[model samples]
Target: MPRTERPRAPARAWFTGPGFAPAPDPAADPAGPRLVCFGYAGGTPSVFRDWADGVGPGVTVVPVLLPGRGLRSEEAPYTEMAELARDATEALVAAGHAAPGARHVFFGHSMGALLAYEVACALRDRGLSGPRHLFVSGSRAPHLYGGPDGQDLGDDALRQLVRDLGALRPDDRVGSAYLERRLPVLRADLALCARYRWRPRRPLGCPMTAFSADRDPIALPAQVEAWRAYTAASLLHRRVRGGHFFLHGPARLPLLRELRAELTRTAEEREPSWTH
Candidate 1:
């Protein structure tokens, strides 16, 4: 009989188990903060690959690969908010190592924003370090989404939903194929988003940056302002000149710049005269 070998683990799944993974720590950074970047709906971690480059040399960008997509395709997508937050918090704790002495930030767009915020609460609940800063883009406050009660819109209506937000086309051949294969995961994620219910808890102690597009139908000014109620720390609002998926191309530069500045400011506040 021939010998059988164990299957190899994928690259992205590295250090994603129980203990915190020892990546770079932001609090130790004399330059800036460590940042974990989250993606939009039906999207994966590849979205922020170039963020560190664009954000300049001070920040370190870590893209989160949600299960059921990217290298974790074999894993099942989470459908409930509690489960999703728990799973994400575990991986983030394992990956970021933002404990003991590290300070960190969360930068999430659309669905990713909600996931990051919830994970912060879950981290606090688990007696772990929560994100010190949160940058939410293209999403309203958690309570505004309410529930998935109206999620059963027609296909045409759904197309309009995507179009209205000007997201990446899920129909463009290769893109469509990827989306088709990944639709189950995406739908599960959307379901999680739909079912999420917000509890009126105490505000987050971290500073928050609410960023959005000037033309985004999904994010109104009022919706963006609701983010202010979630944090006792400084809350800043900045508007860009694009649609919901603005972070995909050159438009991402400004967003990255702002992130770098914030992280730099945070690092400076924690440890002054590092530049001197």
Candidate 2:
């Protein structure tokens, strides 16, 4: 008999749906510079939920919740970088966050950094105004997509990598139950990174900043520095203390300070002539 084949799965969105989640506070300024964020693999928007508190007033932190996790847990996750970028761009535009002349910024950590870069590029390609600044944290330059591979790792290796990346505490339980619940999603994200192929494109006009941890093994210094080629504007690399997930540790304070400073600067630059 001929070999049997399984049917292809239906396409599922990575976002909750056609809309974005509500801002942290109901009274937040609707027109302020929006800091749209994408989290690392197997990560949720909750990781950035508290950013608004540190950023204070004027800037709103809009964390983009990827599907197959968080509130959209029932949906299937995206296995390709382009798919994720397209979904994010559509969601941002549909939610009115990318309106012309609106002040906007993008911040992505680890895997999110790559996604954010693509989103910025996608918006620019569509003839839409891009962000004021792009902040990419804990990720290598997009051109090095074919770096080390982790997609084919077995379950044990996959869990180990996550733990090594600081996603899991040493004391926390890591029985089959935990792995069973988290590994699949993480594996999908790794696959996306592994299979990614960065196509050459015009450098973005927006200023780009790359954040890296001094000791991060994955996003090494050289890899971080490679981000310079992606932007036509200035490219600055700032380092903090910790490993891959430094943003959640001691580096948190300084990271927020930098973010706030950029937000403030952008807002000031865009101020109306009458206000001066």
Q: Per-candidate RMSD vs. true structure?
A: 7.0, 5.2
Best by TM-score: 2
lDDT of candidate 1 over 1-276, digit per residue (tens): 984432433434733322212366445553235787777777777666667677667566667776777557887776677776776677666655456455578998988898889988888888887887899998999898756622465445554555566665544533355545755665677787888889888888887889878777777768987998999877788888888787764568888887777666745473342222
TM-score of each: 0.81, 0.86
> Candidate 1: what lDDT?
0.70
Most accurate candidate by lDDT: 2
Model 2: CA > 4 A from native: 1-30, 169-171, 176-179, 266-276
The TM-score obtained by model 1 is 0.81
**Distance from true location, Cα of 152 in model 1, Å:** 3.1
